[model samples]
Target: MAAGAPRIFVSHLAGVAVFDPNGDQVARVRDLVVMLRVGRRPPRLLGLVAEVATRRRIFLPMTRVTGIQSGQVLTTGVLNVRRFEQRPTERLVFGELLDRRVTLTETGEEVTVLDLSVQQLPARRDWEIDRVFVRKGRGGAFRRSKGETLTVEWSAVTGFSLEEHGQGAENLLATFEQLRPADLANVLHHLSAKRRAEVAAALDDDRLADVLEELPEDDQIEILGKLAEERAADVLEAMDPDDAADLLGELPEQDKERLLSLMKPADAADMRRLMAYEEHTAGGLMTTEPIVLRPDATVADALARIRNPDLSPAHAAQIYVCRPPDETPTGKYLGTVHFQRLLRDPPYTLVGSIIDDDLQPLAPDAALPVVAGFFATYDMVAAPVVDESGSLLGAVTVDDVLDHMLPDDWRETEYDLDGTDDGTDGTADDRRDGTADEGTDERADDGTDGEVRADGA
Candidate 1:
């Protein structure tokens, strides 16, 4: 649903048909999975438990859902066929919350939950339970017997959140909800193997995909191996194509093939194409998804695309002007329009008119040193990689180049907020190197530069 759309009551969604982009019915929603917070904070609406034609229930993550309107749920056409398993952190809205008694903070009167309303947070994809529909007197959801009924803000009720003493991965995650993916990856790296797996399993696919991209190669392989193959594929699909390809390339041939087969054909093809390149080449380092504008696109169009919150700073630094086919391996390489140039132009000015074609584009097979040199010489955060045929392939971001150049264990190193080394050796082999006890905190010193540092524990 779009941000600021009308709230959807949970009761209305029961058994609603779910369709793919093609409008073919895929399943019917059986329940909604939510995670309760620590206080009266509204619970996050996770996703849906949907039943297919086979009567088997599966988990449909919200990230895959594109629309929920006209009594139908729309999906991205990518579904993980594995049966849904309830995690410790999840609560079924229909199964566990309805008809339950919760006390109102004002009157100290108990009310029975009849229905709940969920609203998508503005400017973000996350949805949360925002209002409670309840009866003032005792009555079951089916029973007509009831006193005054009314809808109240979620914070008016007092029985939903987890207990203060509760011990679980969910609590740990909530406590560190603000941590960057790299910092969280560091915490997970120092955790016991069992704890790491538990936390990984509890995280939603999108968040897990982000954290996995920052984790060490061994950690990434181990965590991916432990997940169900169907879910592994889903997480892989959620990741950036280049990172996904790199991870898949590390797997055994049979295992890699199996995961690739489970993914959507288009995504799988991107993986295959990326994996075909040498690990350190431009083709391997470049992200298939970038802001590609056609020759006729206006500065307004390019600016709007660059404004997408999902785009990394590096990717948004410029727009690649191409031919008719705008997708990567586009019709023909035109020229680039830097972000600064877009700002200087009129809103309706054509991007193609002001393109900077003086600098040559990097070749797909450009070596790591050559690619790095291009960035250093031009002082560019990103550069386009074009094939010999003059078709725009993809753009190599400087961060990816740095990730490849850094020591294999650089992610494991510990540095203080002031950019100085701590007294202890910067290694994670001990599994307790820089944790809460050491008063250490990790922060992204420079997100575009891919620099992270510890903040005095």
Candidate 2:
């Protein structure tokens, strides 16, 4: 939904038809999934539980939902047919929250929740429960009684947030909700195995995928091993193709094949293609998904594609201009159009006309050192990898190159806020002591100091 999209009442969404971009009805909304925060803060709208034509209830992540209008929901058409399984941290708005009695913070009066209003946060894709519709005088949601009805902000009521105690994984997740995936992975690394698994299971697939990419190999394998095979496949599918391939390569052949068989055919094919290459080579390190554009695509089109919030900085730094068939393993690789050039050129300019084909692209078999040299010599954040037929395979970003260059234990190494090595094993005690006096400094730097200590403490 857009920033100024009208707020939607949960009651109005119940049983609403869900359509794909083509306007075909695929499912109906059964309930809304939300994650309640630590305090009086608004609960985030996670997604919807939708029942498909086959009567199977599936999870439709809010990210996949393009719009909610005219009493119907529209999706990006990328539906995951897997059954909806509520995580420990997730709450069902219709099934769990509505009709519950909660205390109004100001009046100390108990009101039964009739509905909740969700609004998209300005300039962000996230939606939150911003208002609550309730009735007073001890009336139930269905019961007809003479009670005053009012709408109030989510923060005006109590009892919606998770309790501070006994919500192990849920509370832990809420506390570190704002932490970056890498920082959260670091916290998960120091946790006990059982606790780690609990937290990992509670996380949604997209969140878990991002965190798994940041975790060490052993940790990644361990966490993936604990999830149900179907969910493991889903998480893998959510991950970047290169990262997914790297993780699958670590698994036993049979296990790897099983998960691959479970994934979408196209994603699995990308995984197989990536896994076929040497682990440290350009093909292995490159992500199959890149900003690819046809020769005739305009600068405006390139800018819009790169503006996707999902793209990494490196991936968005430039666009690979190709012949027809823009999806990677794209037709004859034309050239590149750097973002700066796009900005300097008129919106109507064709990317092909301003192409920079001076630098040679990397071959799939290019070794790690060769890939590193390409990035260093050209000062490029990302470089294209093309096959013998001159078709663009994928693009390798500098971060993937750095990940290969660094020691295996690089992620486990402790560092101070100033980027200096702390010279201590990254243990709970070490982390707690490191932040004893420097918590403020760490917070100012990354806003994760208190969260880090909270996890370790």
Candidate 3:
């Protein structure tokens, strides 16, 4: 058992009805939720949610629950769980902690909260929370607030329940709904390659696409390498077609063809056409998902078209200004204005004038280095990709490039090769000179011994 955790059987609490301070019966113990942590897995409690029949299912922070004997939790008092509401920022399992303060080491001008330490206290027969104590970097002595204490206000303490001592891929899998894809991607970066693959395999296709979009190109390739071809293809298909096309383009030529073949015909055709252009220029980085309106369409019609469920945000960056169907192949790019810009302007205002001529557009054959540099030069989150005819092709986003180039591990490496008896170091001679060490393999290169010879007779 963990030093501080108590193991109580669930059978004890099954029949007991829970009550508030007023003695009104709430919900009965329906189930016990226990994650295997360290030693002796103890069962934890998960209260039911509030509904019309149950009225309100309030949370009981672990702190207020004084003891867990038999199966029932012994409370400090008959207080209604409702009285103590969970702060929005509080972590689950851990109690409410919002503005709690802690002293942390001040290396230079910056300050940080020290992480919690897990250790056993022999005298108390329980675990002690050893927090890191820190202050300003200046030496000597500093002014004290109530005589120098490293304590944090109880309010700032959020969830600290280590579901398990070891890393939990399943926990991460279960909490998929609670985190952003970018945060999941960041967490995945810390895991081993195999562990990361497991996490990827566990997610649904839509979620996998989201997480993939957040990962760097190298990490994307690595995770994809570990997955079954069918699974990988399914996830790619779930992604925005243009995003999928961009990622597929980054794959090795052989992999690119294999994956493309596995994709649906429509998706495959879109990717194939996108692949035909140079990668760095507008052709290579542009997304084919764009919302274009026929020049003759009314603003109401355009708004109606935009409301269609089939169109995604990626395809509908406001509306792409285009010429009528009868117009020549070259046509014209009247102007590109955002949805907000159009909505705010007078209804009669032509989109051409409203469109920002300062719009950044790139050619398909343009080099990627140049394109990347242009994104930096312009500080643009998105840039348009176009063909020689000035028709819109696709758009590239800064997130895609970030996922391409960001580093995985950010910690500094510590290496020390001090003393050794290996031949690489001269210390081997000193250790062997005085006496032969038992079990040492002392053998000559030519033979075990020069004196040992065979006679032919």
Candidate 4:
């Protein structure tokens, strides 16, 4: 190939041997993995790929590969085989955790494989193996098998070097570790509802709870229905009480009753109480768990309490400036202090001074429409849900409001410019009938049509 000339498709580079400058076959091209450019640009090359023998596929930078020719392609720089690790692709199985497979990487001794997560990102057709986590190991073949596990982060993938793994594999597959609940939820939302249910079904109860808490109420219901009732009950138990209530509220009457009956009595009671309140109302929306501190508690003490897992995520975000231990918090529900602000502000500053009077809160029984409007008006991501007595409840995030505010087909219609008018009139008929105005075309003045009417008049 001539210098600076674009490389033409040199026969699908699958299974071709990738050679370093030294002529040793360093790795095999598994697949031609293309990394699409993100943001405003369409998909562009991030790099090429070659899978070395092992669990990991090595990343060959686009600039490094000198030529693509018949039978084999050549990579310019001397290859260091010790860089990328190899392992089996992570797979999701029912009743199992994603981070079970611990694999040996080139650099790290051993890392936990969290998920075999796949993400087809926005504005791109191909799925990108987004991240590989090496957080920890619980159980898997590694638990009994003899080998060390190492960690390989998504950031560590230098580039993808393509190889033909088999004779006629139809699709390209990249193995990845398990994803966090938040990540799983985001991925599921991008997929079809049916597929979302399938993926959810594969998660164990604990993992399911994590994923469920992250999903929208509608999705949560659909996924719960797909799970066995006993399994669903177990998942509900693992979820935050407020989140569990939210899901239960969306379930069919019969299913809801069955799941709740299966739930532990204590958890069931809490959910029942929360469910009794209207969905949009403060009571319905409020999280029962909050880190309550008496007005007298020191700022240090308040910070310590904020770390408590017992406190809901919503509660942790806002430290309630209230009378502690009393269920009946007085009109004394003066204001709120953000945990971030609390940490940065002077410790000696009384909680009263730190309390933001502007803290917007909603009362239980407050209409959904009203609360929805409040979120918009305030530009609030989340707001405290409160009761008639001004007691703390759960919080509502702007994300929670999105499904309600958007039309059912919003996602389908959002990027749909296919049927849009191209700034021209509707159709040929419409243009002809003058319903749509085509610009007036004035004939050029050639002076050929000039006629003189004798001024007989």
Taking all chains together, the TM-score of candidate 2 against the true structure is 0.58
Model 1 Cα lDDT, one tens digit per residue, 198-217: 67887889999999999999
What ranges in model 3 sit over 4 Å off?
A: 1-171, 240-243, 249-254, 297-317, 324-332, 346-360, 368-380, 401-457
* Residue-wise C-alpha lDDT for candidate 2, range 67-177, written one tens digit per residue: 999989988665555455666666777555765678999989987677789999999877889999888866421235579999999999997653322112543454456
lDDT of 4 by residue, 1-457 (tens): 3433333331244456777666666566543333323232222222344544342234454444565667676766433222222112211121122323333335443343433232334443223344444443333321333334433444453222222111110011112124446545644554446546655665557767877887766677778887788888999998977678888877778988989999999788889988997665656655565555566656777777778765445457766667544343333466667777878866666776667767557776777687788877876656766656766555565554664457654432323133422222221101011121133221111111221111110
Task: Name the TM-score of candidate 4.
Answer: 0.49
Best to worst by TM-score, what's the order? Answer: 2, 1, 4, 3
Worst 10 residues of 2 by lDDT: 436-445
Model 1 residue 169 distance off true place after TM-score fit, in angstroms = 2.2
lDDT digits (tens) for residues 1-457 of candidate 3: 2355533322234334554433444334322222212222221222221111122223332333344444344433322323112222223221111111322323223122222222333333232233323222222111122333243321223223322222223323433345567656754654457557756766778888888876767788899888788888888888766567778877889998898788888778777877776554556556566556555555654566667775555345466666653221224555556666767766656555556657656766777677778779976656666567776666666654543344443211111222311122211110111221243222111111111111100
Candidate 3 or 2, higher lDDT = 2
| Two-way lDDT contest, 2 vs 4, winner | 2
Candidate 4 accuracy as lDDT: 0.51
Runs in model 1 with CA error above 4 Å? 1-168, 415-421, 425-457
